[model samples]
Target: MSDEHPEPDGRTRHYGDFYGLSEPAGEGDVTLVIGNCQAESLRIFLDGGGLRTVRTPPIHELVEADLPHLQRWLARTRLLVAQPIRDGYHGMPLGTAELAAVLPGGGRLVRVPVIRFAGLYPAHVIVRPPSDPSLVPPLVEYHDIRTIAEAAGQPLAEDALTPDLVRRVAELSLSELRRREVANDTVVASDLFAAPSFDQMRTLNHPGNPVFAALAARVRERAGVPAFTVDPGRPVLVSVHAPRERAVLDAWSLDGEPTDHWVVGGAPIDSEEVRRAHLAWYAAHPDAVAAALARHADTLRLWRAITG
Candidate 1:
């Protein structure tokens, strides 16, 4: 297919450039899909499950009348799978529930919660010596990798401190950590991309990770669409790095007792294996992980004793 198509308004536009196209689909026969970048990957998975999807501008664009073609497509769509993103990157303020009122007859809706960014905000590391109560509380706060390296007395070369650069380091570190945890076991491959890093403040929806796949499967099942599975495993990163996302489904709009709604504050599906890996890593590295925990515990105890 040609990369660009002309709209009725006399402007040439490329369909699905912002979000990749699975296959050419007819108007009204297509599913209206919207979300962050992760939503784009889900479109790939859905296409793999045999569904035709078309990208529409986000709610903010809709409300502002930015992408005129989207408003027209809204009336023709048979189904919509909406995964609301954070309030940045052309995202909506809350949920995409506002679009429900404008759907065509017999239109079905599926809402998946937004993905949370792991390190969008600054993270502070508190350090207090275990043996010395008199030592000052040493705190190091950083959001990007350059600052992190600087704090560790290993500043990177000036050209090697971009957001993508920092993300590469985080990816390598996480991969190594997971490998050590598995220790020769055939671990499942899981690449989590919907996370905040030095490269970007907010993350789009990412697929391939188990939590993302589980959430997508729930949407498909509820809509009576074909089910698709993703990678079964996920990495247990720093909790602050993988914050719980915002809930997407609007309970008030349900025609009856709701069957399912997007979940927040925790993973939508069971991920005990991730937890098990973490525990195993700590167990195997008692001298490092255990000692670190002990130091933190001691710090907390000291703070409590002084306050009490």
Candidate 2:
């Protein structure tokens, strides 16, 4: 779904960034970052830094009808930097392999790992679509599993939100991340997120600029591209910056300041308001709650252990 939803004014976007209106027209020598939302930000970090990457709409924003447009771009792509994606994504040939197959002969295909870090926000989890609501915002779709448990009459012992608990969970997360084999040259985000002092991740799956810059350096090393010389001068991932509680920062001993309010589409929203929306949303969509509980049983079980 498109990231931007309209506000009452019809002028404000629910979230904001590139609209792809003025993106580079179909051209060869394009380095396309193909994957989820993060890929778009990674592309931003790669540009003007010495790399000549094209900014296409985020893959998720495209649908099956956009295949011809995607194919046209792929036909001209000389260096395709991609993250792993499954077959037939968005009812189109958008997967890593699927996209690589359409690349012109001699087009270079490089894979980047999908980066996810949750140690600072253990209660949050991403519940992939098929069970997700249509046109729902990612920030809203970013269900706080703890809230889900409570709304479902399974209140977590929020006490489980402790440092030692976070540490153990982080270890498991890191181990799992390390095992996911991607490109031999892929730069893993585990290091940046581990005891991060700068709030490396804006959300569980959305990382801060530093992580993208690190990945860009690695990509440039492998792709032999130049580094970004100009900064958009502001955050590229400006859609949703989730709450980073002081307690979480303290527990992780991270150096960043705490953020209680949710930043949606460049606007600050009350944390309580977001929670209320999630609770009401959970009540309205019980199937999602069930799916989340089932899909994340192990993580929930770990919390259950602490609660008991």
* Highest-scoring model, TM-score: 2
> TM-scores across all candidates?
0.39, 0.82
Model 1 lDDT per residue over 151-237, tens place? 334444544323432343334434543554354221122234334322222222222344455556666787787776644243322
Q: Which ranges in model 2 have alpha carbons more than 4 Å from their true place?
A: 1-28, 128-139, 182-187, 226-230, 255-257
Tell me how many clashing residue pairs each candidate has.
5, 7
What lDDT would candidate 2 get against the real structure? 0.70
Q: After superposition, how far is residue 42 of candidate 2 from its true place, in Å?
A: 1.0
lDDT for model 1: 0.41
Off-target runs (Cα >4 Å) in candidate 1 are 1-23, 26-29, 48-50, 57-65, 85-95, 117-211, 228-308
Model 2, span 213-296: residue lDDT tens: 787877777776655444657866667778876657777677768776877787888777878888877777777778788887
Candidate 1 lDDT at 59 equals 43
Q: What local distance difference test score does each model get?
A: 0.41, 0.70
On lDDT, the candidate that comes out on top is: 2
